[model samples]
Target: MSGFPLPPNATIGIVGGGQLGRMSAMAAARLGYRCHVLTPEADSPAGQVSAAVTLGGFTDPATLRRFAEAVDVISFEFENVSAEGLDLLASIRPVRPAPSVLRISQDRIDEKTFLNAAGVATAPWRSVETMAELEAAVAVLGLPSVLKTTRLGYDGKGQAMLRSAEDLAPAFERLQPKPLILEGFVDFAQEISVVIARGADGSMAAFDTVENRHANHILDLTLAPARIPGAADEMAQAIARRVAEALDLVGLLAVEMFLDAQGRVLANEIAPRPHNSGHWTIDACPASQFEMHVRAVAGLPLPPATRHADAVMKNLIGPEGMALWPAAVAEPGLIPHLYGKTEALPGRKMGHVTRLFPRGALPGDLGVEAALGPLLSPLLSPLGVIA
Candidate 1:
């Protein structure tokens, strides 16, 4: 904790220039802060809008040093930032969601180990440092399991599904050189996430848990005030709180969980920054996730996280998002956000749209649930929207 306020107009250095950084920079601007975006791409969404842009790879030490010197504090949009790069910047300025936190979240083996050591329940998993060890891990976890790279995997990349004993070697063979982790498949009923913020002074606040729906390993939709039962919601929040305390974290952390058929919540993954599931906060809550993340990282006090509107956020992937933009913009209560991406390649996250309803106005009131069929229905419908 700095034990002092980061006054408005302070410059914050952002390590990645994706949509997350763009959103965070927007929030910082609203609060009278300036952003210096450091990334390799010149036309990145964040770089296009930020106060300053440093075009350099994360491995470029000299560029990172100059970037750190230009800002009062630093934070990252993505978890895959090189440890050596962040270490260089950390020497010059405060890096929130600190390097250590990033290290734990970046590696599957370390992440699961940290969660288990923190007394948090996660999917049963074992680590593999070699091909033989991978076979042993598969035997212990069982067939029909997931083999994930220990590092640099997301959006379902760098992972393989092993349906039988014969699949183990091939799965491991495909992801050679990188260590691995195998977990027994979870027969869960629901997937949800809690976006939490912890200030430098240790004060914490959390947005309502969001019910998440994923397709092809990428998040498709997120509904706030997750349609889960009261007890399940509380349990999820508690788990998030425990994780923040254990990590001694500052800035936003997204905790992903799975609710099994019996309604028990199991931790799935953790992101040490604002996440896709929290996008609904932009249209539904008083303080959006991006704003909270900036506040925490800048050493500002945490604000109350109050959900004033019920909301559903849908991610538009590939060309479909652009093709349907006209309809989205014409829809009442819909808020569209398009990233400054030129090409609309398949499976790429093009943008997102959020629909907000007045407080206490639920899907039942608007027939929204029925309007959203299986093809595009919001994820929270299974539990049914209460507000």
Candidate 2:
């Protein structure tokens, strides 16, 4: 965007058309800006709400060119787009966070190397190109490690665990696209994340560190102001700021981290867009994560990421969650948001509901379950085990 505080009518182009882009477009509408979406699906979650849609593959130069010409600025909802495709978009329009940032995040090897080089802590890892190397790396990282594809892995996909030597060959053979990364599993006390945004002028704002609980390897609940020690909260925020500055990031970034039993925070993954964990900010904060993302990409002054209330965001996944839509809507104090998807496929994220509490009044596990009522599942554990 050439102009500072991008004028109200400017159209912000988003590369992927998932729920992240959908919410981001909704937020941009509040600021008087229109959103243009690019995706292969004709009736995508984002295209449903956006002003315009350019349906095509992200890598096709012709489609990329067409999508680029339709908007003034470009950003992405996910990291699956090829780096070459983003480079093409950058030549036509300003791509916030830059293609270089995407390259670092697109590959696990690059992400881990960058994090360690940035003076941020992370789990020990080694690159594997062949079975021989996998065995040697496993010997060092030890049993009970994880093997993951270097690209296109999310929601517990593209990764496998090696509990015994018998598990190694089968996993290595099953995982696709040669070149994998083996990570030493962390015996952590809890899983947490921090979402932050940085403007073109170097100003930054970060949300409170929140604990994330998962069910079947998918995010099920996020507790705002993670019920951890005060020191751990400060540490998580510090790690996120360091990463934003290191990347010279010009958009939103979410740092997924693990708080080990030793009370240390280790970077697990980085997503350069709005994250699922930050959804609570929609009801808890003066400025939601989506608003901060649009503001940063539009060159607006960054505001303090402050929250007015505590909240718990629960993801509504698959058929079971969709089954509760009516009750969720009727439940008092339950804030519901459903994606415009016709089918609630298994493991598909259909929508989310949020429950808010008075500032600093977030309750413990039993209370959270009780409040969630119909939506609550006992899979949540306050002292989460990361193994």
Candidate 3:
């Protein structure tokens, strides 16, 4: 933490060469820093833009050591990288936000345990390791709840909704890797998130609370400065900043939350790197979340997380989303960012389009579609387009 603001030519090592890493690397380059990426995929999204790429398994000892030795500072773009591998890298070069922070965010059990203890509100949950425990947890949490793997789950992959008694045994037998967690179902009115960056000296910058709308559990669009009441927005941002401070984080962290029907904010998940929800900042804010991440890990002074324009960020997922690319590019006032991805695979995030509004001019649900022009189609469900 002492000698920093990494020299201009110094390289920053990033684990997981995904789209998040790609954008972070692009941001780093703008600030006169170099990036080296490590991933198993050949020609990974992040690697396409980075100065160097180490193609290897996340747990490979040789690759971890070699990557650590090459960079002045290290950070990760995603949380799926093995914590043990990160610990190995930390021994050779500084890993900002620390491996300890990553450990807390890696597993749902550990994450929830940390959040509740940190005074951050979260859904009622119980860990289940066996059929008896599952039954007991179900009895306590009740019939309608969510059963999920405590690790390696994202985009709605590792969860089952239990609505009836018949769902118990089948769901319990189907889920893999054992040791699950049961969360009491929350009647949420809206989904929102906040992205924040914390520096080594504990200085922090938090972006506005943004509303997230999803389709099939994949993010579809995000509204910066969520249309919720001011108090609810404040609560969401406060939870994010609190999580950053609690972890003593020195990098970007995005905290997703459920604003319940009663106007209470409950933390859902925490990602210690850039999040899909924060992509709007790339076009709306002077210092994007990616830039905040680079500055924090490189020991540079943090900039205000200020935005000049209100923005609606739309995700380009799968082949359907990719189809809109031509219109997205042709439309005036739409800022397009395609993640150098070759294939438009199903459910994959191919790229994104951002539409800016004058400050305080974000439109209502009905108006949002008109603002987006030809980007949205009738085939999409109303939830994805807010019809």
Candidate 4:
């Protein structure tokens, strides 16, 4: 873990062979590093791109050991990797971002506690382990709050809204028999994310803050250089850097936050790998988040996080996204990236498209939605444009 650099041609093991891993593998190849992907899926996206792949269950000790033995270092694409599996791998080889980062990020209660203890502001929240505790938390936090499982929730799953006393029972019944946390909803002006990479030497680089727009609780679009005031953008980046340094992060970390009506920023959640919001970096920034992640974990010097152009990134969810492929490919300044997923299940993130504009060409007077709508109208019209 203390190695200053891993020479070229070294093997990097990636756990969880999803799109993040796929992109990370591609980035590693660009740097002359080979990738070994370990996942249970035989046709995983990362496996398709990596130099080697070990197909096995994450918790299988023998498979984990073999994977560790094949690679010079290890990193993961998702936070859900079993802690025990990571511990076993760490014993065999180094796991960047560290097991402690995953331990905190995989659980909502623990992540919030760590952030708060590090002097980061989060929504008012309290832990609830039982129906009685849920009731007590409701009484204290009040109505219109979110009741979510402390672990394994993503893309808005494992959550229920408690709007009134009548909602308490139904919400509790739906999410029962699991550890929960109730978070008071914040009336926010914007939802922004700061994607940063921290090197082993403690150096950190942050991408431009992105404003996210969600539909049905799934991230639909991201606009880089968030339309928020300059001061709020700077504050968001500062908070994200503080979180990364506090966690002693060795790879990429995405900090999602809410800019409240009073312009106060509050941390909402953290993703330990490359994030959907940072997809804009692929087309706009000199060094993408995936490349930065690969460099950080591989002990390579970090790249400058500079944006060459203004950009808008849109996720192509399900069949609706596939329908727009023809138009997307024809659009000028548009870059389309597909995950190569076999099925286009509804609400599934199948791919994304980013459109870059000349510097200063995009009008700052218009809001993010307004500025990007015309450019993406062809692809979005069929699915009902995101407002």
Among the numbered candidates, top lDDT falls to: 2
> Positional deviation of 362 in candidate 3, in angstroms?
0.3
Query: Lowest-scoring 10 consecutive residues by lDDT in candidate 3?
Result: 378-387
Q: Report the C-alpha lDDT of model 1 over 62-81, residue by residue, as the tens digit.
A: 89888888888889996787
* C-alpha lDDT (0 to 100) for residue 342 of candidate 1: 88
Q: How far is candidate 4 from the true structure (C-alpha RMSD, Å)?
A: 2.4
Candidate 1 deviant stretches above 4 angstroms = 1-3, 364-387
Please give, for residues 1-387, the per-residue lDDT of candidate 2 as tens digits.
456678889999998899999999999999999999999998999999999999998889999999999898998897777877888889999999889899999999999999999999999999999999999999999989999999999899999989999999999999989799999999989999999999998999999999998888899999998999889899999999999999999999999999999999999999999999999998889889999999998888878999999999999999988997998999999999998998899999999999999989999987887788877544634334211
Between 1 and 2, whose TM-score is larger? Answer: 2
What is candidate 3's lDDT per residue for 238-294, written digit by digit as tens? 898889988999999999999999999999999999999999999999999999999
The number of clashing residue pairs in each candidate reads 0, 0, 0, 0
TM-score (C-alpha) between model 1 and the true structure: 0.93
Candidate rank order under TM-score: 3, 2, 4, 1
Worst 10 residues of 4 by lDDT: 374-383
**How does candidate 4 score on lDDT?**
0.86
Could you tell me every candidate's TM-score relative to the true structure?
0.93, 0.97, 0.97, 0.94
Cα-based lDDT at residue 287, candidate 2: 89
TM-score of 2: 0.97
Model 4, span 48-105: residue lDDT tens: 9999999998889999999999899999996787889879989999889899999999
What lDDT does the true structure give each of the candidates? 0.85, 0.92, 0.90, 0.86
Lowest summed lDDT window (length 10), candidate 2:
378-387
